[model samples]
Target chain A: MRFVLVAGTTETAHIEGISAAGADPALMAHTPSADLEIVEYGQPVQAPVMPVSPTGCPTPAVITRAVHELTEFEILALDAGLVRPTSAPTVALEAMPGRDIRHPRPVDSAADTFEAARQLGRSLPDDELVIGETIPGGTTTALGVLTALGERAVVSSSLPENPLALKREVVDEALAASNLSAGETADEPVKTVRHVGDPVLAAVAGMTIGATTTDTSVTLAGGTQLVAAAALARHAGVDTALSVATTSFIADDETVRMNELANDLSLDVTVTDPGFHHRNHSAMNPYIAGEAKEGVGMGGALALADRAGISMADVREQVVAVYDRLVVDESL
Target chain B: MRFVLVAGTTETAHIEGISAAGADPALMAHTPSADLEIVEYGQPVQAPVMPVSPTGCPTPAVITRAVHELTEFEILALDAGLVRPTSAPTVALEAMPGRDIRHPRPVDSAADTFEAARQLGRSLPDDELVIGETIPGGTTTALGVLTALGERAVVSSSLPENPLALKREVVDEALAASNLSAGETADEPVKTVRHVGDPVLAAVAGMTIGATTTDTSVTLAGGTQLVAAAALARHAGVDTALSVATTSFIADDETVRMNELANDLSLDVTVTDPGFHHRNHSAMNPYIAGEAKEGVGMGGALALADRAGISMADVREQVVAVYDRLVVDESL
Candidate 1:
């Protein structure tokens, strides 16, 4: 199975308290770009920039890297939309960076981006694809897309507190701005994403649609953002063997209860824990404390590692090694 | 096997009589870009622009698309450097378009582009790759690269006449401008490319290095440009299973005598004849007459189709169909 990382940025990430993708909200725009670099190269090429939450939790790319080292899975990164350029080589679709969801049109050129990604999906050599995404404030935009498609989704957040009310308010205002009500866009998937979703949603959903039309099976990998993609794909009439994979942190979150969302979308879901809660590493403590639940294909990577017969202890060790090498060593 | 088209451009192609890729020298810069779009979509997304020779020979991408249809081989496009934006989605490497070979540094960021492509090559899912290229005036640049690496190479030309004297003069002027002599750069492959080669050479050579390090085997698919890449990779100490695949037109070019170059590089070579010389169609005449002889993975695509039990007649039929659909229909 091939692991493809679909990364993008949204203007919604600039809003204070809306995203926990980086330590400083002003620097969140660089989070997805940095995350892709870290996954591809074990560190960012740009000096002294790494994706971290305010609570000191590292980006989920570390987990993905560990899994890659363990299983040797090949990776390909796709740029849905990027505010800043990444050091990693990416298949560019010339997609525009998403606007704030409160804007009537959050994602310009959604249809074009979708069609391009669909063409890409149809040409991929791999028959099985696990598509992961990295975007700050992606869950809030996930909420936006889910609501616009008329789903009552309690999306998971990277933050510990979940910020349900804040997400709800943002989605409500976004729908009102687009002159759309819940369920109004059920039949118009691309239009719904353009109105309220982010570029990653459109790209991931489009790839899934195209891949599934062939012999390829897709595993949408992330938290609620990927859940939103699954919902969008299903609403867009993609019928195939599709599954959602997320970290146990998201599955067990009190506010998320992701299984219900998966069930609502008629999708199968897989949750992976990597045994971080029981580890003694201080760097992993924030994960147990629920700061960075899931964002960058951690769950899908873990599942691949598991299928390869790699132990969670080994994955934790590699994660710690990567953290120390990329994060701790860089700070020093 | 996966087929990847690595495309780029050079200011060298803008030089008079150096390139025959497009109907006008002024328009040659768009030839690679439009070639990629045609290979991906069977037509350029932008109407009224298709890659063709000044003599009305269609781009070799038609042959590549025909092979893709006959064998369902997965295809990917990589942008080594492009003078113009293409309608097809591409894996962007941020490589700079090459300057005239006479410039001291023809390709900026050669090492960086190489490293990036190397990383991408290491991550590709396929076990075998057929890498091709599309660039106007590529043979002249290939002559420049081959000579810098100390090879007594005679590169093929897209034009009916090989233009050997013109290519040698350009290479000599380029070497003089760089204040280097032939064979002086034998030990510094990346530096050699930066001094006189174009972006596609560096990108293709790097990918060959990276892919050959793993279980992946590579076929450098084209005429002498790919032979130059093979030479670059070898001088850079890439010791692995690598071969050059090209059309019979290149193999039969009296000026090129490609077998000698392959023997000097110690690389195995495969030559594919698509039987265009015996075809009845008017469009086949240009190819038989040795204009637009070989490019855009035509050689490797034909090899793959032949292995897949596809007949040359079927391949020719698809090529004509794509030509009519994309070129003939659009013009009318």
Candidate 2:
């Protein structure tokens, strides 16, 4: 098994109150780079800022890192687009950071990045690939992609209150700007991402589609954002078996229809609960409050840990240790 | 098993008569990029030019491509430094091309690239890694690194006639410009590469050292240039077992001390013969004449093919087919 974390950025994340994946809207651009760096190096080496929710919850990379330390699975970082540089080694696909979602062509490198990632998918030397993503405001972009593909997608938000109206308005305006109707781009998956989606969606979709050509079984590791990738792959004419690994938060989100989306795409969905409420860590309180649901493959990591016979208590302990070491100690 | 081909370049290759990996001195800058592109995509997508020796001898990438078509091993291209861009997907390490060896600091990104490659090495999923390199004028840089490390090194050349005196003169001048004596930078292997060696050497050495921390065994796949990487790893105090894979042409070259260098570094060496002389094709005549003996992981690819029960005749037939499809036919 191999863990591939695809990191990218979108200026749509800059929209105020649209994303909670970073401490501030200005920090959203840096979140993807920081998340992957923290996963690889235990801390961010490129910047002083760590990826945290608006309510001060640590990014799910803490959970991913804990699982990696326990299972010792090979991890690879792929740079679809990054607003900031990371000191951790990454496979750069030379993609440009996405513009605001209202821009007709937000991800100018969509086709190229997809082709590049598809080539990468074909060459991964593993039977199983768990692909995760870290892109602030990605759920909104996921809604845009799913809507463009003719799905009435209700995406999960990192915030306690899902910003359904705000995401739908943004997608509507984006579609109007691109002169696209629902299902207009169903036949052109790459063009769909280029019009209204971020670079990470195109990359993840391309990787999944490419992996289907081989013996590798792909696990899309995220929330509604990865569901958008599954839709993109499905529209691209790939019928290979794929599964979705996501947090119970996403599976249980009243605003999102994860099961319906997975069923529509013929994807088996696995939801993992990390039992964070039982842990008395202040840093994990936001997760308990549903302020930050899932990103950075938290659910997939937890499932791997479970399969490796590591208890949730052990994972939670390691997560706290990582948080203390990387977040608390580093701040000092 | 996975094959990683590290591609880089140096301004030293621009020096006339310094390298024969390309058709002309100017073309040398594109050889590394083009070679890997051919190996991955069966042809160069970046430019119309294909890598060929001054005598129109095709690059060894054709052989690697042929073997890859036969035995489907995951092949990855890592960009250490590329003067020309390749359309093929590659893991970009953001390394700068090495300056002329006459400069005191030839490869400025040596330390950073080495560290990045080291991280990548530690995360590779495969238990066995075959690391090859395609860098024009790399043998001369290898000699520079070898001399700086106090080794009485004899390096191989792509040209039939070994340019020993010219390579020595360049290395000697490089040492003089750096104001360093033999073995002065032995304790600082990264510094040794920074002063005189190319980025590919540092990348290969760093990857080898990093892989030593795991169960993966690394095979340095090339000739004298790889020997330089072995020596770099050795001087860096890495005691883990490593091996060298090269062609019979390099092993038989009287001007190169392949066995001596491997023995000194305690690295097991494997030499493969593709039996190009037995083929009747005009392109195969170059091998018969000992021009462009080995490169682009041809030796390692051949060894893998042999292990898979593939005969040399089958490999030669595929080579001709690839040449006809990619080189001969594409040119027309």
Q: Tell me the tens digit of each residue's lDDT in model 1 across A1-332.
A: 77889889898888778888998976788888888777766777542377889877888998898788777676778888988866565767647889999999989889998888787677564679999999898999999989888886689888888888998999999999999998899988899889999999999999898888877889998889998999889998987768988888988898977878888888899888888877878668888988888878999998888889999999999998888887564666
lDDT against the true structure, per candidate, is 0.85, 0.85
Query: Candidate 2: misplaced stretches above 4 Å?
Result: A1-7, A11-78, A83-94, A98-136, A142-163, A169-197, A201-332
TM-score of candidate 2 versus the correct structure, residues matched by position: 0.67
| CAPRI tier of model 2 | incorrect
Best by DockQ: 1
Q: For candidate 1, lDDT tens digit of each residue in B60-177? A: 9889988887776656688989878765546677599999999999997899889978877776656898999998888898998888889975899999998889889999999999
| TM-score per candidate | 0.67, 0.67
lDDT of 2: 0.85
What lDDT score goes with residue B311 in model 1?
A: 91
Model 2, span A234-259: residue lDDT tens: 99998888899998878778888888
